[model samples]
Target: MLSGAAAQDSAASATGATPVAGTAASALIGVSVDPSAVPDSTAGAESSGSARRELVSATGSATQPGGDAATATAAVVDGSGASAASAGAAVGARHSASTVGGDSVIPPDSHDTVVILLPEMPAMDAPGALEAAAEFFANPTWLPDLAGVRDCWLVTVGGEQVTSGDPVPHQFHGAVTAGFRCLGMESLGVSFRRVDLAAGQADASRAAALVRAVHVKNEPELALRDGAVYAKRLEIDAVQRGPARDADLAHVVIVGGTGTLGVEFCAHYARSGAGRITLLSRSGETAEVTRRLRPIRALGDTPIIVESCDVTDADAVVELAERQEIPATVLVHAGVNYVRAELAEVTPEKFREMAGSKIYGTEHMLHTWPRTPDCRIVLCSSAAATFGGRGQILYATVNRMLDVLARRLRAAGVDAVAVQWGLWDLEGPLHAVGTGPVQAAGVTPMRAADALAVGFTDHADHSGAENRLVAAADWSDVQALMVAIGQGPLLDDVVAAAAESAVVQPDSPGSGHRDGNSPRIAGTPADGHRGTADSAAYPSGPDRVRATVAQGGTKAMTQFRAAAGQPGAAGGNSANLAERVRRQLGRVMGADADALDPSVPLVALGLDSLQALDFRKRVQVELDRDLPVAAILGGASLDDVVRLMAGSQA
Candidate 1:
């Protein structure tokens, strides 16, 4: 079925007129099926009904006649049988059909097969263009119909985006294909293909050949260039280290230098003998910033400058760039801002805020910097841009732009690389959103110093690829999460690496299991205790209190009261409830129960949305009381939560 734009383009092209400005000329140029092929008189009706059902099942909505733009095409089958025109008319679509021979018919085996022609995306810089493109490609109206087909081929143009070094406006297509590939693997169990045709190669014969190739091959990624089909594979090139790799560390400009990562970069460069360092951030120098810089300053005679500059403000960035006396030998764009939100909850404004620094900030920095060979531009992108993460659609989209920007810079002979970093073992931006979900997905946080070392060394040695992913991951956990999230093909290399180095290590000290394959919650103790070690090992003070909460029951509560040491409440009273809440909160926040003051608000104790949910669930399960998420995260103290839970129970 042709989209409204596609139909109009096809009509215009057929009449020797110019196609619409923003639409590609597309046509359904296959032979029509014989109406008498179906012996059953009601076969056409059944097929039409099946098509509608399939659409509904795939997208949760069925296309109705004369509906919106998406439903411009519909399935229409006559009483005799389903033909190309009748099929289109049945589903509210327009098509031109031609019959080859009188006996020509759609084979029975090919009934469930489908080929989806994705429309070419226009420039996304225009207002509402990104949203429109995202809606069209990422959540395409045609995607739903693929759910009904046993075999499907998703074809698009512009193989240059993936194959060539030049950057193209194909970010939307990249995201769309990645998402569908995962969807196909996890749920549909259907054959899927993303055929990227070269210029002037968009035709029925070329598409048919690609579809035929897909049937015989099991490759997930295939691109057509120079009239030949090629399979795409992602591989890691071995680093070849050379001398003077650290020469660029003499002078450094670290953007977002007040944040956790910024401080780490500042300290690392200082220790590496950087003669001068300039730190730019939205938050100007504060006492805490001074305190953090003190250690770096003590390392050597390196002059450290901290200035307030929002990188997203183009004027601010330009002003800073112009005022620099000595050009920075190294430029590290570590600035980032984002909130953990599902795609449905990500408004355009929220996306803009999240993407502002990374997109416009990177552009502004790159434009201002002199393109000298000595200068190295290091963009701190995230693994979400590489393999995607849950609740990070906007984050991933913006980071992917960084990856593309790096490539574009390299293509223009600028020394630039985007490092797709994984979770870091630091109290940085991710901490605000809570690290529970990422940890649960099997990503072990890497030490900040070690990750930086590896990223820089790898980039210096292996300068071929403009974008690289540096992460330490448990492949089994990653694979499981990907499967759960309907992700496919993107992690094939990781899967292979996991297979190559699979080992069975002995269980850790507190874990109850001997087998190495069992899934463990991030901060839970071996015996299912939230925040304490085994009671027998540390049989005193807060440990005993924590153990009692872990081993909860009426008898355990009695034991907890006896072991409280200073608590006045007895037998399921507010004091007992407060202790349990404290231990559980400590567990969820990955903090020490004794260190968490009861009077302090949970938010001040670093409680986040994910932690709050986890705390709420634990309360529901252990305390047998329902606690609202708001009551936990709405600036409530331990005593407040205890009172709230006690009241709910009462």
Candidate 2:
């Protein structure tokens, strides 16, 4: 953090205000200045107009790298032009104070350096606070009024200064061009006092008032909670500006088109109103996957090309590329593995089982996918890539490889990303994904359907930079709502929001929002506001933002552990029982056994969002004890749902 006087100096300079020119700033620890030099607290500065009397108000605290709280002092110019000392703001961020203080004065001929005082600090241990504070210094802004900075300092005291603000983060800052990384730190919290705001005798209050606009008056200044979960500064800021409302509905190709995650993505992009779509798979499953995509297929002539191409075969991939059409975008998820071994115990075969998908397949996709000027490449990574686990070397290594992969793509001038997927609920097909069983853990897993929706949005908006998308369970609901939008004026607000952000929309080939069953105009206008109905407007990547599909806060896609009352999925005759249950459900929804797609919106029919709310009631009437909502939602298919129907099946 820069000194208060230094802050005022730099900020004023950024605004093009001429510096008082001739006086130097100073820093002194804990010494009360002479009464003549300090500004009187009773006086106040008025607003732009009116009978106002408030130059500025102060609150918040300053923190060192890791300690809880530390005190810092700034010398503000007094009313008589001498500098005075003052306290900082609330919420733990330090700032200058000149509102009640006088202008700062200095002996033009004397060599007096403003001695800003930082008293002793207390210990603090907020998990990401150091990273946040580091980001703040790297780029300090207050609300809508922060200025660009050139250089600044983060000083720690020695001896008495050392005893008080002990163990300050002593990263270098005196000369210039020094690089100090703030990946993780040990200290935080500091208290600051104005040492001296001496710009040719500018009054302390006047100097403090210079930075009044930097403080937050309306919105609450949020800080990352001290934990593993808090988001990075860039991510937190990006999330607040909101998600992009407009998207390209033009053409795109998703290579791993049949896997649960891949197909789900195809459906979302199709639903998001893309023009032409080419869905590919290793086998001949694309046709069936496309057939199940009714909402997207309804978009008309949107060709869902199902082709067989082995991703691991370089020649086959090259041949596939030769026949492939260049899409505005390409998403490759051809690499997926079934490895589930402890790192120490994992064998070459087990490693190959996992490697065959991510590495070889992705390499093939990179070589084969037809490139376009507007095309973007998405490399799906995992949360485990950033944070490793005991039995997840295969999974974690594959995820991390994306970072290097994205960088290489960037160096090649192609839009690329390594999206780290959080554990999704339906990752049952994936070997490394299972996180024990869900019932024992209260983790909220993401559905493959939801994960795909978020992934597609990432695909459409990726700017080619190295990105990591962290999918939280909340993102599932939010992105699901985004993908559910039917076109026309209803999407006008979305487009407008996108335009405001200077982002572009894809050229969609289909007419949107033809929901004939609703009473609302085919595509009704939203309350037509931005900000609300928003969760997807943020950017798509961050090293810390781990792509949160269904896993993250919930459990990994580990194998399902059967409850005491139910038999294990593999050992029991659950398949036959599940099929019978599915048939019953199909009858309830007025559809054939095969009509339902695992990921489509149930709201399309008579079911409302509240449909899930009724599961507990169903459990009581049909199966006895109340079952969790996830129990019903996580069921592989509606046909064989176990939680509510388990008792009946038994």
Candidate 3:
């Protein structure tokens, strides 16, 4: 790694005025500063001295006995904690690969004060370089010169091994990482620095742009995520009456354009004055069903195109994108088949038929055509993905896959969103429209045209929601009509109302929970799902998706089955053997009967290996326990199987 060293003393300028031989700085390097000692933020948490220490010219400049100019600055804000925890990293957490070969990554920290390191930039850029240096000082860490200090350092890295290697041709930008180089020719021989921003979607994008600017300006090669690759456009969303002209306000597309959720999205975009809109479907006629949309065609000719396109045709999709300059800004995969069938009785053909339009369809869309960088994808998933509707296993599995596509696309510079939509009015699609299940569920299913119009046009409020569930069919209407836009005028109230009714149990054990590996409720919760406490709402809250047929996708791949069947690692956890059986029966059956002991016989708790295996999988998803899949399936009684799965890992 290229490194830099320099001697400049301004550390005390911002805190201790001028250090007296008797006074010491609060935190030498952060670990032990008593917060109460110092009154100001600079003096930091606190110190153990009487006289106020002031800044002094304390830097010692070292000329390179040789050379390396990678300036490294490390600053930390220490919180009062146990000595063991404060001194260094947590004991076991810093292992190079707790999960095996991957490098140890640091979790986001609250006490991370900014640290700025400036190297003696090469000459010739003069004005720009000085400006860069001044801006770089914005770091909260360093005590600034204006706050009172003197000249800085002309230093070079010391005490490091030197390597002699081949000389290569000069590129426009300096080497970004070891193997990569920034191809920008103008960035060579310049200086740069990175900055932090408020923690939110808007600000994060801004910060990313700032860092990218420096890399591009300096013509230096940068680490992948550290540069332009992370660009995220923030559009104006005309519905919002803000001065900002963000990129998010650009064009957006809805796939299942005629469905309940699809229309709502349209309304939001229309109300927000999204610059343009497109509703994609298997047929163009589906787009012409709504009357209010006739005016949308003119909106000063904003171009709300209704195109006939089969999602399954990957080649045609690529053609559609190449034909349009703006690209499909937001594509939702809401087109799905909601079939009901028990796990034991379902036929393979039925699974294929229902899922073909979405699974194979979406795969064709993403893999064959891919998406534009600025586009945002919204795939409509279902609660069944989490609730495990016995008859809808195949359907749920397909939906679960969509929810997770976001992370997979993130690294590639695209965003994917899988939203678990509640069932629309029965008549809306799958179930017969007027059915009791649809009626009791209280869902207002918009017609195919209404769904497309609403989802494509509305720019309603997003605040006050806890789980991103949208219930008020009011916005559904507004969306279809392209009426009442703004940063959601009565947004909070509406969101609060919708949230109150939608939540199952705001305080239940499974409510408002989050797991890093699971996308069931991931990303920046949707505009409707304001991530907050779902208090006083339905007490049960949506049943924890954790108890579903699937939650962790790659974590429980089919390969795990083959791995266990192969050899030694297959032995089940001994501690789990007894305890699991009791829990499985009690939990799965919703049996509040009595306190069952782990030692109880399989018959007593309700045995059967098939059920046991199913129970074990649910256990792993709900609680991060790993039980051999076979342990419960191979004739092991409930108690025996539970014992195997419930080992200490449970």
Candidate 4:
């Protein structure tokens, strides 16, 4: 509990900014002000009645010294002392900085903006220091001189905090990012650089180097080595390796073996030479279980045991473990019940149903087995646990507990890791809805085997981190992908922040950067799959889709001709064209062509922003004519779309 004054003083000495007006400039974890408010040192000072405001709106929760709530607002003024909107609507969403434990923005008339930096410390102290540093940054400061200056802050945190392969760290980062973005949207000219301290503690010199990077508008995660700071780049080595001849897996126990991810895990281990896999779940006989077992059966004579066991029942789990003759070498917990509802709509019963398998199930297994150092326990968590997918509050909460459990088990010397995974390819409920929705959020579905391969690597590498988060796309793309996937209104501010951060780090290499002519898709057969050479590779998701479309020109034309039929031969009549357009639209809508009304807007028929983009692309290909998006989504009926298509051809 360091006092606000002492921390501000430490920051002032470190940054060399004058500690003017007491602690007014102390709580500046971040601040934004119009530069014009502060007079130039070379020019004579001009007094403007107006004052600059905080980077974000203040909650006015923190009271003033005299018992009144402080108002947070800034008056804009030009050189002539007249009020104006200095930086107009460009400011992002205005939120109370006070909510983040930071003070309100200085009264419109104050001057000075101070940027606080985290102090150099060892790996253990880094998390605490980071929390302290953010508090130090919370001191409110308003400087006319700083009104125009924009800057970035680099906060180095624990590698375990990030790479523990869990959603907890991701969730922490997501919330902090959301707050910082609100500041940026307020035109505070502030940005963030989070350096993962995976390598270890950094010295002052290295910290200074990071500052220099931020000053240059390059916000990269930095690490210290040999007394020098180096940028930590994010890379995905997705090149599939050859299956192990002597796989470490033998007797594998898969919880929820009938579920999508669980079956994939079994298949992966089966290919890796597993002799026996016991599938534990409430129900053993399921069509999904039967279908997914085909690939596993093809790999070898491995016997798959489907046992009826409810993981949530501790007594059942204990009894089942006692009856098992072979101790499980690898344990895969992939059981989860899906639930989607708004916070208010979610009842406690529904929450318990989702939490039973994720939280209670893991608890039961760990209690039943205790600590077996040789056994590698893998928990399949979700990306939604971090990003908190739309209408999935309970899911995120329970999944987060999995990451915490991993840490606790790791602390006790158990070999366990929780993986925060993106959507899986052609699996479960998502498979029924199609992959477009998840891909729209910028996540490429990792083929089931590929994801499990990463899990095996995690268990083997013992990266020392208990949690690891893996995704197919760069982290930056996630926000946009979420928007495209239909979380636009929910994540509008988040998307804006992500886009600005992208602008700040133009030179940083992204995970999704094309390696060559083709983008690599996760889980596609790599060099080792099917005994093929490593050379045969294909990209996944949109990149894969793009490549297929590029090579389908002749095929597209053939399909178009078949679709056109007699109407196409009748010189493109408007009525015939409208009928054809209706059919095409119906196909995209996943509806019956005859059931769709010709005069209804596509938007009303469930055409979202991402769906609209696809609709446009499909119409362009099928009709051989490009139609304006407005004519499709903006109250445009089927007949209207047809007219537009016909006019383009003419």
Q: Each model's TM-score, in the order given?
A: 0.56, 0.38, 0.34, 0.46
Error of 2 at 353 (Å): 2.7
lDDT of 3 by residue, 185-298 (tens): 011111112211111111222332222222221111111121212111111010211112344656667676655445555655665567777777776644344564665444
The best candidate in terms of lDDT: 1
Q: Estimate, for each residue in 1-650, the C-alpha lDDT of model 4 and write its tens digit.
A: 00110000000000001111111010000000001122223211111101221111122122212223222222111221111121121011121111111233334224212222232233222123224323322322311233533332324333223221221222232223212322321221222233332233333323333222222222223322222233321111212223333434668888988777777677767766687888997988677767778777888899898998998898998888888888887788988566654433546566566667776687788778433457778787765644454445555555655664564555556767677666655557545646565554344554444344444432222323234444333222343223232222222222222222111011223212233322222222222111111111221322221100001122223333434452352345787767766776777789898998777777667765445545644554556544444345345777777776565455
lDDT of 1: 0.48
On a 0 to 100 scale, what is the lDDT of residue 624 in model 2?
31
Stretches of candidate 3 off by over 4 Å are 1-247, 286-292, 295-301, 368-371, 411-413, 433-435, 438-650
State residue 583's C-alpha deviation in candidate 2, in Å: 43
Query: Total clashes, candidate 1?
Result: 12
Candidates 1 and 3 compared: the better one by lDDT is: 1
Stronger candidate by lDDT (2 vs 4): 4
Ranking by TM-score: 1, 4, 2, 3
Q: What C-alpha RMSD separates each model from the true structure?
A: 20.6, 23.9, 24.0, 18.8
Candidate 1: 10-residue stretch with minimal lDDT = 7-16
At residue 481, candidate 4 shows an lDDT of 29
